[model samples]
Target: MGGQQPAEPATEELTIDQLAAKVGMTVRNVRAYAGRGLIPPPRLAGRTGYYGADHVARLTLVRELLDKGYTLAAVERMMSELPDGALALGVFETLVSPWTPTEPEVITEQQLAERAGIPHNPETIAKLVELGIAERQDDGRLRIPNPDLLRTGLEVIKLGVPLDAIFEMLPKLLDHADAVAKIYVELFRSTVWRQFADAGLPAEGWPEIQRTLEGIIPLAGQALVAAFREAMGREIEAVAYEELGVAPDTLPSTG
Candidate 1:
């Protein structure tokens, strides 16, 4: 009879083979990890060993670390230092990952040239790569890590802001941006990280620390944008008052 004898219950435990298949790992690797004490030993029922959700979580984390290029020894070190490796990984990822997440887009060299309105310009492409607006691929195409940033830069160039001038200002702009970033990071380090450290990094606190870390990125971006907007408005008003002899208050608002 081909009748499915009712599906396995959701919370049913898995055997070694079932666990291996569930997590996409070979039984051998699961056994090896278990032997190395990377995962907790399975529950025993007479002669049979059973694994549960905890085993799944641990194995999944191990696989994720491997995929992220961490060596076994490094992962072991991490596991030893942080029993809550998954939570720690969450905070680590939030801090190290790009604040502005975007889907990467790749373009052929011809497409790149067309977009920037500069035909056959390797130097321009190089500059774009240098600015991190694009990455030159092994296959001789450009990978735009941030397509929106690339489009914004192209629009600036269209507005007659010479690419060379933008390139010239880049170093100073980057240095200033770096300084601003340090200020924000320092603020967090001085307050949040310091308190967490002083508290001996209690297991109960990592969640709050991780949430604060996630929040700070958008907060920092918003603050920077607001500050820059205010500064730019003041500078433009001053320029109008000086050059056109119009009172700063009398200038017509573009908006």
Candidate 2:
């Protein structure tokens, strides 16, 4: 077992600065999260207000999720779901973290062109930014928000797929991704998350919730890939048969 985190006793009084320092956060950030109702209101003592361990737990979760690339709005939404305002760190992480984790990278304009085999032009960069594949930081550099996606794009480009074709595909792909994401979110929210919320977030339910979610995340990812493989094969084969007048049954077996 790892060393136990030395958290403040539940009843320990903490000034705003002390609480911020204890949680390794800035006072401004703590207040911002508090304003968003991501944390419980501090207890007011006439001219002074004080935070406690509850604040620590909530802020810690918020900060951790944000560090994992979740937007603040998303963190606020997830925190708002917990009626009891308590969380198991592992369960929360399992619930929200991306299944195929991607570490983002920053690249120069020329590097983007070199790696992606595209021209180092403003129009080309604009297209990438528009596609949500890259982001333009204030420093005038490009950040690949999803490096795996960039790699995939580069592979497609290497196969002689024109950037225009890729650009055309990107929107449709994004639309489908959103649709698929919605389906999974709805299924899980309706079947699992809501039930947990309805149950008043029982203390004993944390472990079970964590285990169930750990299974769901990767299973969903695998399911998407498998389903797409099957569907893609079918679509391509249909094109070969219908458009190209190829006999499906006479084709050589790929497997």
Candidate 3:
């Protein structure tokens, strides 16, 4: 009775409704999360259960990670070994946040269907959602998570290419890209971040690293494009000779 005060709110104890509202979670979700140990179980206070802000904050983190394609099991592991907020925010800004944009543009399903030149069937849209390429908003609208990739898919479809072929190549392409990206990441970690930490200038390092990487990327892209063109030319020549019995010298050359 003495603990229940009129003007002073309990900082350590929040009612279920207050907890849900504060954490941006539904009451059902908060209870479910408590049951699943995603967040710590609330303490019993007489007839009412109460949670604290730490639980609310942790649950919010779990929800963010889930929205970023993390499984609950993975989130559990991450929560167990949580990094400093600065590092977490750095990673979030650098990697996770770039994938999702918040600009709202109104477009009908028919517009997307017309753009892709395919009937927008429920199954196809669902497949895109499941693949994490697109999202369905609570407002009954389709959110194109990455318009560039969607545009690429549309172009591929326009060229009469089957999605299965693209799907097969996509993983291989992404694996190669990831491998290349890791080299630079290591370079940054070793050279830039390490140097910054050693010099006690860690706060200023990431932006400098970002600037250096920004300069490196376009040059790397041009080199990659040139290498791919030459390599693909050689491949086409080899295939032509093997399959068609046509030598490059024997064919009419373009001047």
Candidate 4:
């Protein structure tokens, strides 16, 4: 019934800098996104660009799309085809939520197959290499493509899921997670590493920092495990109850 935005004064428009700050992106990135058609082009007010609330909404939509499984290129195309903001946002969020990379690591193909408890066959090994989950080296042994994928795949195997199914989904999950990680990788470089170098931290200081992060690793892992156990228990119980048509409280006592 109105324009793409609510009734508002055009004079209240946000400049490129203002929009970038509001959306947690760099002005360069905002310009790049506009140039690449990731967001709608801003209105030109003289030599400067001005955006509105609608632009903010589009940025949020792009974030959600990237979080889901949409590549920037895919998002560019999808934005063109899909005019319904709410529906697109919902779909993008759902796709992005479950996808993330496993840490990168090097493990032999045989080791990978063994850990997954799947038969070690040349064909399967070749397939893993082809899918980029693992790669074959010059010495005729394969290593995991990424440490995160290695860890996640191991967890899935431990959960009793078939290796084939796990392999099938790994490619998709790793791709999305890796894409999301790009932003933080840049952040770490720009903030932590650069700041450390600027402070004249000795080369020896690097090892100490590694040790510090490593010391906290176990604590972080324990916290994650505790949270996972609680969440998984609740989810499993709810799913079982739904399937059995029984209330959680009405289930038979294990004791």
Candidate 5:
């Protein structure tokens, strides 16, 4: 008897329907991706085509890239350049996934007025628009891009701070914040990210890079808060000494 032919390596095979369901894509889109050469053509068993784990992984990666604001063409180019492996998928996923998601909450004019504790004064609304605190929608509703910031503004208003004075100071505050943000971003890009890029971003280095980025998110916030508190305390103390004729050092220690 002829020697038994070598057995084919066991692999999970999924039909088009199964593949689409597994990757959360429509069968039509999967077929279209194959046609566009974004994904590998399925293995053919006579008239039927079967997808494997690689196909599922590629589809999932494509979906993630699209979700992260990459255009289809850009995604295709990226997919083409990436080596065929799970590591490449992981790298792109980590790099492209949003650090934080900001979904704008829509509120009606009446709701916004209630939140801000202000009447529907056109002059006040105009000032808010100019200050970038809120935006008016075409549908007549208002969009508070950062509700937390709006709430803070309202609190300041409640404290009897004139709206005009607050608006006048906002530009300077934003300018300083922007400068600080630029410095931090440039520092990361020049030092950490540049070193990684220069070293060719080896596959083994991805975890460390990811961890560094994740750690920076919270650390950066804490550093900014601490620095702001220290600076504000000094300024407050100086103002009190000059205007109120009271030295901060002589005041009872809160601690």
Candidate 6:
């Protein structure tokens, strides 16, 4: 008789809730993806279904691709071609998860009005939505995507800046920021990421690449602040000396 085959390793199984939590997605989204065939159907045991490591890895890959601007159809096509073991949830977690100082906060319309120091006016809420500063949910609660920015805007309003002026200037500020972001992203892609890709993107260097990307976040913020200050200083000096009729030599040193 042939020797009994070695027992296969036991695989860890996760319930639907566990799978959703592990992948940072909602249970509804998990079901939607499964229904759309973007993910493999979970194994059934009795009345319940169970997911495994492959499901987690696939979900992470899907999220990463979507975050990179791929459409759902494109994501489905790409996911179909990925060979088994091509993705690891652990690696993708470190690489794709955002490192941010702020988390989204949900507030009722009344609470939002109190925060903004305004009456419960639909026009004001509409303006906030138009600026992409807040979103209105089906439940009628407002979602502030970044509390820091909301606080900053509220402070500006407290400083007696006209709300209309503030809203008008915000779009211009966003436009400039978008351009600056593109420049830095392109710089990184053309330099560090390009070299890594040229090297065939070795798995060994992935951690280093992730660290480098994380390190650049704060550095980029500092650089932007420094540059903005310098430009503002130059503009103030120009307006003081030329437009305001003040002598350049009489100007106070910004240093």
TM-score of each: 0.67, 0.78, 0.52, 0.36, 0.66, 0.72
Candidate 3 pairs with clashing backbones: none
Query: Which rank order by TM-score, best down to worst?
Result: 2, 6, 1, 5, 3, 4
Q: Model 2, stretches more than 4 Å misplaced? A: 1-15, 21-24, 32-37, 40-54, 64-88, 253-255
lDDT of 3 by residue, 86-114 (tens): 34334444554433555534455667778
Q: What ranges in model 5 sit over 4 Å off?
A: 1-102, 252-255
Give me the runs in candidate 6 sitting further than 4 Å from their true place: 1-55, 64-70, 73-101
Worst 10 residues of 4 by lDDT: 91-100
Q: Model 1: per-residue lDDT, tens digit, 12-63?
A: 6999999999989999999998888877888899998999876787787788
**Local accuracy of candidate 4 as per-residue lDDT tens digits, 55-111:** 776777877667556798887876775444444454444433334345446667667
Q: Comparing candidate 1 with candidate 4, which one achieves the higher lDDT? A: 1
Against the hidden true structure, what lDDT does model 5 obtain?
0.79
What would the C-alpha RMSD of candidate 2 be, to one decimal place?
5.2
Q: Residue 245 in model 3: shift from native, Å? A: 2.7
**All models: lDDT?**
0.82, 0.83, 0.68, 0.67, 0.79, 0.80
Model 1 score (lDDT) = 0.82
lDDT of 6 by residue, 194-215 (tens): 8977886666766676678777
- Compare candidates 1 and 3 on lDDT and give the better one: 1
Residue-level lDDT for 166 in candidate 5: 89
- Tens digits of lDDT, candidate 5, 1-255: 899999998999999999999989999999888888887888999999998887888888899889768899998887775445465576555544443335667888777778667777778777777887779999988787767677778899889898788888889988987898788779878999889778876767767777777677567778988888888778878888899999899855432
- In model 2, the worst 10-residue window by lDDT is 81-90
Regarding TM-score, does 5 or 6 come out ahead?
Answer: 6
Instruction: List clash counts for every candidate, in order.
Output: 0, 0, 0, 11, 0, 0
Indicate which candidate wins on lDDT. 2
Give me the displacement of residue 148 in model 2, in angstroms: 0.9
lDDT of 2 by residue, 165-213 (tens): 9999989988999899899979988998789878987777877788888
